[model samples]
Target: MLLLSLFVQPATKTQAATDLGLTVDAAILIDASTGKILYEQNGYESLGVASMSKMITEYILLDAIKAGDISWDQKYQVTDYTYAISQKRALSNVPLREDGSYTIRELYEAMAIYSANAATVAIAETIAGSEKAFLELMGKKVESLGITDYTFVNSTGLNNKDLQGYHPEGTAEDGENMMSAASIALIAYHLLKEHPDVLDTAKVTEKTFREGTSDAIVMKNWNFMLPGLIYEYEGVDGLKTGTTDFAGHSFTGTAVRNDQRLIAVVMKAVDANGEGSYKARFDATKKLFDYGFTQFSEQEVLPAGFVVEGNESIDVIKGKADTVNIATAEAISLMTTKDDVAKFTPTLFLDEEALEAGVEKGTVVGKIVLEHAEGKDYGFIEGGDLTVDVVTTENVERAGGISLFFAGVGSFFKNLWGGVTDFVGGIF
Candidate 1:
């Protein structure tokens, strides 16, 4: 039989960013693998998250495609309202021709790479019956991501008041679509981590819809920073860029450098005179990416089956074996600065002590605790208390009457003790 040895190291903190800027209105940088925030500024601060809303739209649309709710090859009819909205300068039009049918894949490209409002609304109406229902779905997806500071009132981020069918260009005084810088970063992280394939769309600098169709419209990429923003930055892919008179400017940009990928968000930032400046977004992203790549490194904190020294096995009574293997469900890793990486480790704890024998397999043992050098708790890792029956490989016949007689005598004494206790209780 092979034995599985469990070794658990105490949790410790690895080195991390010492100074992430605090002056930015809202900014956040997180480790994609572990969701650890390396640098943050006004992380929870809420502001108008312009085209960044499309990131959520991208996620929902892809989910529907995969779930068989919609198919890429299926062509959709473009409504008159969808056409009118596409014509507005304030909106990012996909240049779609009315009645010019397009596939789900084509629409996705327009929405993801170009932040096309028309493409977004078309996809929204198809999946959720109406744009409002789609927005509700977007909000639900946001909540599922563990984000608490955000709300979605429309699929296109056109502001709530524009839904009235008037003020076609959208309104500044409308109920604003809101989100935090950290939340936007989280959305980016989700795209890369959960749906890496999204890069296939985001990375594209250009694409055309309905090359064969007579009324096909051409779509241009909205994010200008992708082509030639930074010399060292290559494989810099595409992500949506958003700006409204009231929402200011917000951008969620992701780039790949060698084997490393980073996602960053800038909210409430504008140009020289304060008009949704993509340049500012580009510059801000450079600061975050440089800081992350140069100073931050990913490190494994715990390995699977990590054992707690004192709680390796629990004592069980009347069972084949006295104890069972207690181990973690999976390994944990985190991103930290170089200095703190050395002290990182996994700490385990048993919520309760071992049970007296006779415990069955798969019983709840206790929870394990993992911590960092900063004393921040990572999360609880749990273990199971199971009974392993002890059996001999080879069978042996009873060597005898004498051994049998001794076993009988022991049983007799146990019964006698029980009887005596019963008699004493009756007398009392």
Candidate 2:
């Protein structure tokens, strides 16, 4: 334990800059294994997400490739709008030739590794034929992922004003796409779980667009926390970095050590001087990662087939048996500290219809809602199952007709006798 604490210590040596707490607009730390948040401050407040928006574009592109809707080698045609954006040295871009052709693989590498703005637009064009249409697709995608706190105005995350007059219509001219820090963390968490291979490209420190060619350009990854870069932290690989006049410096960072992976987000980080810079964001992320690894560890919080004492079973209606046993559908574990192990509470819920009907073993009759006081459980982006499912442990059959008839007769006579006894007692 002491060794792990030593190894996972914050990489940033300066305390004066970060001791006043995280100097960011918002921040979050999450355990990727369980969609549970470890810490957050203003995480739910919507703010400019900047280039971190490209993570969605990257996800759709990767999904398209995986589904065979697009090929890595498929050539992408350059448009004048894209051509103009690519040539703008002020914005991050790899020069593209309008007269030339580039493959999906080439653009993807540039977009992922270099945060090339035009390259992202090229992918959007290929997938949905226009940036507005691509925004619709992005809308549908985020909806399916259960993301609600977001407003994406453009594909490249560039301020719409930077797109000149060529910007997609129906969006504000000066608006920047916005999302909460928690929302970005959700995307990063799912990205690692669903398409882990993104790390293959995101980890690249430097890549060339076209080696020894006229359009040749050298691109360096904007994420500086990967291994050899300045502000590098151990196990840091992905996910994206964002900066703009409005968004300041934002980064979604993830790391793995001791088999536990954590995702951290720092939105608009600044130093003690209140100056937003690359180092500030990395330092902010380092604090989160350090706090996550050192203070918390993953352990089994709830086991499978668990039952609430004294409320373990429900009454069975019109079945051979009057009651049935039930237990949790599965086991659950969470990333937490030893002190928090006692804080978890699981509540059960039973389905009334299932209880009324003859049910088979393994039938899902209810669920356990696990709650804790430390943080709100985000569960997963899609949905959390059962929290844990409560299922019947044994099959129950319908009672025979003869048994029903005898039970009905017994009930009738019992009521009659009770009424007669009540009348005699009233007279006395």
Candidate 3:
């Protein structure tokens, strides 16, 4: 990997949530297209995630299905523990008979829509045979995703105490899954990007489980910010909500209006009086959404064919030409304040092998990523620099032996002079 840098002359702008007065312990808003953090506060501090952790569980299940290890029509039988947990009417659940076998589709609908704990446990058991084992799978998946800060103890995000001594081992009896706002946002980011179909069920505002049957129950989504719901936010679609004594009220929300989409998360939200309520979480999320939509807009940071100043081409050692022209393969747009649109510098990272002599005209040689000139880059949740491919704009053929001999002589003198100067300096 070749490192490159650029200079830009401007200071960009950012509007902090502190100025907006967000009422959450932690929060983050990101652009869905580029994964750029638009706003954040206390985003790295770990806190209870409640059922928002279900997004990770949803990811695993979807992956298993995609891998052919499981199927949507697969049947699941509730275990004694999951059955008992489901029987607690105080918890979010639809009645599940111990003798009943349900399809994975229906159970997933329960978990994603109503935040049903029992249905989640059943899905966990079906996929991994037990919640404890499923926890291991979740761990491996998290590690593979490069997440380093998290505490996941169960497939369901319920406190271990809620598991009735049947919780997964190696966790405190009273513990619930916890993750930093940035970390959980990363989880949701992966889930939405990897399995966007999760939105289909997540966007369902209300549905009846087992319609026309005695056990039928109406499942209204706990995400009140969704369209046609109580709070009724337009352009809102699929996402999750969570609530518990430990988690207070948290939400991961996504919405798109006029072709721009934003994902926002708020944890432990409180009202003006510092009291937690479902409304408080939604209200805080609204602030994030409003700030993202109003304070920021997408701007093309670098256009295709962008070339680094004074480094427009790669030096070719034995090519027909002295160098090959290379530039950004595509345009990159970032979500930032309109005033900050022209304040980004693109840093190029070149691939020496790809840029070598005789390389094809369209060969990809590097990548270009943008940073705010005034040092205001929050970066993406995936922990990777948002970049666009850089490719050769034209090719250079291998030079003839005679031309190579001449080039080699020039290179030798250049190196000899540099070495002589360094030797004299060192002696002096």
Candidate 4:
């Protein structure tokens, strides 16, 4: 739960050039814990997203399974519609037989690992009765997440040209699934955050689907960042990839190192000849992850029960104790760079008035204003400022009636004597 507390202040946006020089149409790198965007280029420009849409499809299926709406062991029979799409030579698929029945788990593994179009369709048809209906559900889910710019035409992310007559009634014939790099990153973040168990499926480099049967199919993950792949990257884990005539080579990759996880998305990475470059997307993704781990690190900024240096005590009027000590409510942490560490500063602000008698402990009294001096490279702090609540450390009870009377009399004489002494000194 590495989220900042409400009282903690956010650091100011200090722009620094993250000059990675990537060769892609759109890209983004984000801290999975805080949802902070570390680097981005054309992240919001919409383009065809190809099979990356299957990640969303997986999300819908996983959620359905979790809610008891569907079960892994439940089996579905392949239909003519599914088989027809599977036979398309341009699309990636696990061949399904018209007479074969597959379990929800089998189809899901095929769809997730092999990016199989037919298996995706079979699962969609089983759950929603049609890919169109499943797409409608996807649209609603995307809308609920506050992502506005995107469209889903089919479940497998195959171009409408290849799926011309297979679409359900009332679906647009010209539609192709399109998404921005930011939207894709957001979807990946939500997917990993909510259903981390999906990683178990994504982490498999190779496995046998429909094992020990005559129709047994072998599946190998296409994500090159995995451990045994040629472009093996340390800490890289489950995600999805896409390529098409329109979408080019795209990927949504996630990795974890030292307990910090990051998600990187690269879309439309191409070669000098304007062809989808398989190596370019993987290269760009690796660079992004490298930059994130090298430049930034998470730091704990404030500890719970921390007392403000100068404003630790507040006077308690007519109370059992003369004053009460105050401290912070919770600890806070932020991802920071080396330059930010040098300029870090914390300022404390206290309430102007004293606390009244009968005040209770844990009452809000002031706040801690955490800041950093502006560096020469940037006029503002790289991470935004943070503020945390200051609370009373102890209760203060009201004085008894007899004690209050004596205290009032002693206060009156002290003031009167001070006034007389001032007059006598002036006369002399």
Candidate 5:
């Protein structure tokens, strides 16, 4: 019986979000380097972002600095507009004096650690001429990131201006500044990916602004997950935290273990009495990091040149040689549980068409995937993915399409003629 072969492309792994025992309104855990979703709950659920909005603002500011548009040491004079916004009194103010000034670096630290509303506005004004125009830049950044749910109203999230009778229309407060745990995590990841040095300031547990400049203001990170916590978790780095009567408490955090870095975000978590919101986010994030690091280990399955199928040589058509040796494409590794190691199955991905008469040596033809037991004890145990490439013993010139077509037609006619001759011979 003749066997028909079909060539199919390699399959991409589908990520599944797992539920953790998190009471936070929304949360997600992700692998920083790979953008792999390890676990998520209400990951796409949007909520008021509060000062977490500053992350996007900080990102834009960093980009401008990196592009030479502004330098950290460059002084930004505090104009009346910046000073007036700082005096809102409803927001977290770093208290910029109308006559005093600060450098880009100072504003960066204030926005990142203290979550100072005034510092955010001053930075925005210095960079984009007005906070409104700066927010327009923020929207563009969100759009480029593929974040669909978030909107920006002002440099600092002090609610709409109408709350203070400044602008009644602004009082209606657009929900333009909403975001989900997933989007926050992605933004944090990109920020770290591009400029890892930002973490240096964010991780600071305590610092003070220019001493005499603003009544000797002491600044401390509101994020409880930073180092110096009672938990003493290793490799935990500071990110950001936010809380408003409307937005609740939100936090983004990063942790590293054994060379693996993970980012976790929690949003809209509230205390039973509507306080201690930051503590809730801290607890949830610590739980996620602990759970991820404790359970899974990376396993290597197929090493390069490992024999997949053996004892029989596959045919190579119209080559300098009749056959060739085929090997696994690359080494394969998977993150899995201890039990999965014993029962893992590796599937070979190959295109049989490439094994035809004229084939190129060392062309990637397929992939190897290890499937693990699904659910509970072994849930999400992927045996790790692998690739397979063909190593031909001899090179063959590729046949032209026109020549191959004519040759195929001629071969069909010749076979027909031979069948007729064989029938005639039998009759005779």
Candidate 6:
């Protein structure tokens, strides 16, 4: 069996050879489970993210609820500030009543599905007492997540003009919500991993926000990749889309197929002539998903408890047993394309010192360096290496004094006899 051990490390974005001719200024594709970035171009450039910022809002909201800071069924009064934002014709909103009261769930659905600015303000105020406080929390959360490049000025991803007097915290000098394609991917990854049920809301194509009321509002998801949409892609579920004069069109899309989930982010996707195009972002995201599912696959590169072929057993110096068997403690799996699988290689390195008596089982004695040989042009293997520790599989007790003495005498006589035979044969 192939000796294998799984090692968890920070996912690093590795540059590869495949190019999709993307129209987006920045984009990235990442494996949700392993956090492996399969493809990326200008992924770290910070730019306007638009409504994709709502995903972070959703994360913050869910976290607050989980921490008992808020509840879904809890009702929050619609304030004058929220109502004013809802009245802005240029902005997306659910038209909340100034005097009307809605539950946290209602406001969250409005914000998540419709990207409603007013609904976002209502939820933010309810959670942190004001949009300013919520913005502070969002900033803190970004830092906690290890994201260095980001600016969260508003909860709804609305531009400064739209948020003018509403957000007392003002805006970043540039005004619009700014984040890199890579940071947005990390945000989405954390959201889904922590609260998978958010998909329950994201998957909904159409629903009534304030059902059976005089202010009943019909809401529909803007994500075109979702089912029933014009460019529906298989496995696409909940996510958000954003478009503005400054930000253009952006999307953070996620899908699951064969138990493998991937997150694809496209920021500032423009037309051939560099103009904002709604379809550009979605189309680019679809291309990424297609490339990931078709060209790459998850494989068990190493098996658990795999015994090293030639070095399955090592001599135990001064031990009761002459040698002891050894194997790896864990298994290692890698995501690679079929063509790249052939490049997988493993090399075993063992401790040169002799194994002494009373050696315990599961002792770390050596390690295996797993790597991928470079292909003709592209190198999918990041840094070209992964290291796993190897351990002993059994215990070896010290041999008694008499046993050791007899073993030494037997070894000397055997060597003497062999030398005598060789000498006599040479003479003859």
Top TM-score prediction, candidate number: 3
After the best TM-score superposition of candidate 2, give how far the Cα of residue 185 lies from its true spot, in angstroms: 1.9
Clashes of each: 21, 0, 0, 11, 5, 0
**Where in model 4 is the C-alpha error above 4 Å?**
1-15, 272-274, 303-323, 342-389, 398-428
What is the lDDT of every predicted structure here? 0.65, 0.84, 0.85, 0.81, 0.68, 0.81
Q: Candidate 4, residues 115-189: lDDT per residue as tens digits? A: 888898898898899887988988988876778889788888877777748876666776679989988888888
Best-fitting candidate, measured by lDDT?
3
lDDT of 5 by residue, 100-181 (tens): 8788888888788788877887788788887767877887887777777775677666566422432122424544367887
Question: Which tens-of-lDDT digit does each residue in 1-428 have in candidate 2?
Answer: 00101122222211112232899999988888877777777787999999999999999998998999999999989998889999997799998987778999999999999999999999999999999899998888887778887888899889999997777888888988999988888888888888999999999999888988877899999999998998889999888999999999999999999899999999999999999999999999999999999988977778988877876677788788888888987888878789777656666666663375477889887677665533334344334532787798898888888987887798899999999999999999
**Model 2 TM-score relative to the real fold:** 0.87
Lowest-sum lDDT 10-residue window in model 5: 375-384
Candidate 1 RMSD to the real structure: 7.4
Range of the 10 consecutive residues with the lowest summed lDDT in candidate 3: 9-18
Candidate 3: tens digits of C-alpha lDDT, residues 1-428? 87876754343435442466888889998888767888888899999999998998899999999999999999988788878998887789987998999999999999999999999989999988888889888888888888878898888888889888888878899989998888877777788888989899999999999899999999999999888778878778969998889998999999988888889999999999999998999898888898889888878777888888877888776788878888888888778877777767777778773344686877887888776676666767666666898888887888888988988899999999999999999999
Total clashes for model 1:
21
**Candidate 1 global TM-score:** 0.74
Q: Provide TM-scores for the models.
A: 0.74, 0.87, 0.89, 0.80, 0.77, 0.82
Candidates 2 and 6, the one with greater lDDT: 2
Q: lDDT tens digits, residues 1-428, model 6?
A: 33333332223334567889999889988888877677888888899998888887889899999999898999989888888888874688888777888899998888888888888888889888898888888888888888879877788888867764766565654488898888898888889989998899888888887789778778878887899888899999968899887788999999999998899999888778877777888889989999989887897777778776677887789999988887777877766676766555666777754588788999887777665555222222122445577788889999999999999999999999999999999999
Which is better, 1 or 6, measured by TM-score?
A: 6
